[model samples]
Target: MYKILIVEDQEKIRNELGELLRRYGYEVVIIEEFENVLEDIKKAEAHLILLDINLPVYDGYYICKEIRQTLDTPIIIVTSRDSDMDELMSMNLGADDFVTKPYNTQILLARISVLLKRAYAGYQEVVQFNNFKINFSKGILINDGQEVELTKNEMKILACLTKDKGCIVSREDLVSYLWDSEWFVDDNTLTVNINRLRKKFESIGVENVIQTKRGQGYFIE
Candidate 1:
């Protein structure tokens, strides 16, 4: 199911929207924290966002800018501010769609479905974890808004782990997978690759990616 993050401050409206989306078979996440809306967005790891412009401290425009800097997660502005200027500003801030309040719930859901289809086409290629988006195709790791360059081997290792998330991946299995790619690398070199990957993740504010199991191989925790 697609995950939808609602950033509206109105309690009644937030719950209403959340329940409505839930009825449509979508996973809904509501942001209770207004101070660090950006942090909330990252943690949600949502496929799309429903934002209200009239927020407490920072408006939705600023929050939209923060999200645009790193993620391409589709955003739809949900506000009572209905004007060309408001819509234009939202577009400039990288909002994908804008819907005013008092709008039809069915219409809102339709718009969300359109944006999700355009952005994720059923599901996204990247895997989300701890605010990190790992794009196996590009061999890149995007954490928060920071981009971390990943080597081919590093991508392979991560791809393996993400494939079997929360499970142990034996070193011997990793070596076998690498060998199939005709990239012959010994255990020491594998360790070097893992360390390099960990450092890159740390550079992007992720201190740990892979964890050791002593006699066992490794697991991403």
Candidate 2:
């Protein structure tokens, strides 16, 4: 799922936007504190940002400029400011799109879809871990001129684990991401797949990449 960070200060509108996005299957993150918004955005690792012009300390345009300095994350200016200058300024500061207040739900979703598709085209199909590179499209792990093929489940599991890098991913979450219906998949199935991934990595002289967090879950460092 794609994660979207909302930098709106109004309580009612923020909550409403979050609910709407969640209903449409997008992960929603709201920014409550504005003092360190830029730092928060950095930690969010969100695929996109929903920004409001009227904020607490720093306005959306300033924040947008700061973000553009370091991040390419798509930003959509959603504010009550409907003037042409407002939209033009947003665009000049590197915002991907602009939308006025009381936006049509369907239109906002469509814009988000288009921006996400355009922004993430050909993104993250291959990731590096340690000295090896894992290719998701080909389902192979390569290192030192040697290649090791991975099974469907193994590839999915590895991809999920590597998505957050050092974060511990719960077993239930992993199961949910791997299978359509978690009810039909058992814990042993995931354990078996993880074991297979470990063996595959070991075959290519990589070890201890996937670590278990006892009762919590697993993580790759």
- TM-score each candidate: 0.59, 0.60
User: Tens-digit lDDT track for model 1 on 1-90?
Assistant: 677899989999999999999999998999977988888787666778899999998999999988765455788999999999999999
* Deviation from native of the Cα of residue 144 in model 1, angstroms: 27
Candidate 2 has an lDDT of 0.84
Go through the candidates in order and give each one's C-alpha lDDT. 0.79, 0.84
lDDT by residue for model 2 (1-221), tens: 67789999999999999999999999899999988989998767677899999999999999999886545578999999999999999999989999998999999999999998775554367888878998765557998888876544566687788877799999999888776466656568788778878988889988888999999999998
**What RMSD does model 2 have?**
15.4
- Over 4 Å off, model 2: 124-221
Clashing pairs in 1: none
Model 1, which residues run further than 4 Å from truth?
A: 122-221
**Model 2: what TM-score?**
0.60
